[model samples]
Target chain A: MVRWEPGAQERLAAAALELYASRGFEQTTAADVAQSVGLTERTFFRYFADKREVLFAGQDHFQQLFVANVAAAPPEASAMEAVSFALDAAAVFFPDERRPHSRLRQSIIDANPGLHERELLKLARLTEGMAAALRDRGVPEPQATLAAHTGVTVFGVAFRLWVGEHEERPLGAIEADVLRDLQALSPSVR
Target chain B: MVRWEPGAQERLAAAALELYASRGFEQTTAADVAQSVGLTERTFFRYFADKREVLFAGQDHFQQLFVANVAAAPPEASAMEAVSFALDAAAVFFPDERRPHSRLRQSIIDANPGLHERELLKLARLTEGMAAALRDRGVPEPQATLAAHTGVTVFGVAFRLWVGEHEERPLGAIEADVLRDLQALSPSVR
Candidate 1:
């Protein structure tokens, strides 16, 4: 049902990342990105609205994957549990070979204020999608919203750890540690 | 002691909000703000870095207030509990009279990408500050980070509820609901 072809978007994204990392995001041109993929500028436009869109081309698919996973979670799962399952589903989208490239994209986003805002908006949308999925699964209002917020916050922390070199743990291991961290944060204490 | 003079900051903030609401944030000049308060532009600058700073001016004080409260919590409280207590302290800072102004400020920030980016950075910093506070309170590495992240996410959800409601309830009630939502998130159900 998606209008954009997967390979075309992926090629454009990979090409954009190379151009952005090499020339800096501010210095990289649409023509440079198009030329890197041996595609015309008009063809690039067919995939993305502009240069910034190329950097975030796969976000829609990620949202779809997340929502679908949440929707398909076991019926007995709590709202938060369903969110955790959705996060695990999203992990398959990130591969080891692409980690460094994604890290570079995150770095460029961090450096650019406009991109950071867009990133925040993207995160907000993801949380909204998760909440909608939870609602569809019979979860109540505020709980659905809270679970979605918690899930995204967990993802944010996990991704930051993934990008940082802390004993070179695999991304899956780091994500598991993040989930454990959330579990260990109980209100009861000595 | 807090650094900024309270009354002066309050007047300038009120004037700026009024100008921003009526004339628009960009169209409203520093001179207009100063004139509204029957003060000089120099005095306005003394209170705020610029027109934009008027909207963000209280954030640092909020950080200080939150961290200090966390430090002051019972040493035996769990990391999340301590952070929750600190959030409660910060809740007192959100006076009933200020809700309208807070909503207006959010609208302005939402409409401007530059302001929204700064807002996200501020939220990130607050998360970091809460994490540091937890570490100081003897919480361990990753749990400290999770505690901070959860605290901020709870704050985020609570804020959205607080601002979205046209007829406002006490912030204490909203904070209680946010904490309950966090507690109701049972992980064992998955």
Candidate 2:
């Protein structure tokens, strides 16, 4: 039985993730993802290249979000401040409603070495994008790159906490906690 | 005619890297690598699964070095200090004679997306391994992860500088400079 749904792309993506989680990514096909959503393989192809893309399709947009937010920071902001702003701005990407989905997606990624590598690559790209944005804001070589990397690390740490079982705090709050932990890494920062 | 060599694996790896750099990683083959070194494909197989292993064969040893150094840090050292000690300890992995080879290898990786992803994954694992080491030394969750990530970032930035043209400093000195730059990111740290 097939039924039409609004946001065909979103539905297909969701279905692909679910199928990848249960059946394993290698076992899931494009047609399987589409059929799970009561859609056709043609419709899935229109939205994504394959089942693997269901996890990575948002990477470019996510990188853009980090870059844009960094670029939008106030002129007086330090490189770290710019990254801090970007980190806060990234919370919209994981609203209260999206945590469960994010957790599931993360689990799927963690369970597969190839998918985990893809996840790390995307985060590496995000760090590069943020560094470029910071450089454009007049932050110097190592500082821009360092701050960008730091922010991304915080994001990674906070994201895991956000998706963890007993954690109920928002991503921004967790990021603040992680940022503090980052600052406390040395006696100087303390 | 093949000549007996004292370091056949090293010779074949060197040949593989040269071929990959000149002809592109995708264009190179295991047989080509072996033939370039005056050896047979079967000999190459005994040392490596495929041509790609030429670039990645040291990853486990690399991770082990990091984990070992982190574990050997002074008991009273903070998470960041332990990472700093490990960073300095890693200089042995890149001697003056190896800089040119590393530079060539990095260039090859930068030119290939698959290789670049593998590079990032290796670094990510290094970070995780260091973090786990910190945890074993009694550092807590987010702080251990944060410090581990910051150290790896410094190592990355320092490795780039070490390999860059006109940079005369050793890997240890460049790491110190990058670590200083990382500390100066936030105003409080300054």
Candidate 3:
């Protein structure tokens, strides 16, 4: 339940992306982004550690949404379905208002090795968070971890599918495709 | 296959690990490693781009070996078992002479954030390589990728299992336990 000033953070991120697209990540500074966003440098620092952090602040929010969804998932849901429920919950958190900025953030992160590494670290953290959430709900060891990983892998594919084209699709659709992909891999199904 | 000066790379890795352990990675110079191994710094540079490169020089070699094993694996083997066969090949490749150095190498890579990130990148590359190899051998798209990832995930668990105090289990045994763990997570088994 970490509290964040989302408005300030979003403004800073938007400003940072503009600077990065025009200049570059290495050329842009937090002060420059803050100035562009009509905020003090201190305000920018309050939201993010540096320019790299701006691209990833949403990951923690997404992780929280994932855990909360998993915690409250229906008992009848399969392990993979529980994961889908979480992704659906996350889509609600990432509204249309944020998609353009998110796309820009992703682009910048993709171009930078340091940011890419942090993205991997964030994914690992989210997987661990999901595993912990599953464990709290009475799922056993290794399965809990493996299920969490399976969820991330599916999410990875679903996300790629979602972002592959500019048109938006419901998170549910993306998740369903991921489940289909997973089932298609099953020995009996294959 | 790319040719290597036989054991030259391994010798350099051993020398680098010893220096990194004693003097720390940041403090250790390439010249010091070469001096310890009674080789010229020129030879070391010819083998690796720089000092940091020494720690990761074997990653491509391991990936190639794993992919080749996957390609040669029995067609009838389950996806998990096919992955296990590749991992077993890796287990056999673990050098008896490099046990102490291997621990030190893992420690050095673990302690450094940059090194650890590169290691993850390497793992991601290997996962893709395995997927491509599987696909070439008639495995399909998502299944090929999933099988590769599942194998890599189990390898991670086995590596952790191998490192701790209760280290009597051979690598093969640890990998077997990992496979059992994965099957135990199956919907029917759970």
TM values, all candidates:
0.77, 0.91, 0.75
User: What C-alpha lDDT, on a 0 to 100 scale, does residue A102 get in candidate 2?
Assistant: 86
Native-vs-model 3 lDDT?
0.74
| lDDT (10s digit) by residue, model 1, range B1-190 | 2345458768888888888878888788998998887777888888788888888887778878988888899989888779878878867988788788788888888777778767877776788888999999888877887888778877777777787758478676787777776776755422
Ranking by DockQ: 2, 1, 3
Measured by TM-score, the strongest candidate is 2
DockQ of 3: 0.23
Candidate 1 lDDT over residue span A4-115, tens digit each = 4457767888889887877788998888888887777777888789999877767777778878999989999878778878888767777677678768888888888888
Error of 1 at B30 (Å): 4.6
TM-score-sorted candidate list, best first: 2, 1, 3
TM-score of chain A of each: 0.87, 0.91, 0.85
- Candidate 2 is graded, for docking, as medium
Candidate 3, superposed: residue stretches over 4 Å from native:
A1-6, A18-32, A39-43, A67-88, A95-101, A111-114, A129-141, A166-168, A187-190, B1-8, B19-29, B40-43, B70-85, B95-101, B132-141, B187-190
Clashing pairs in 1: none
Clashing pairs in 2: none
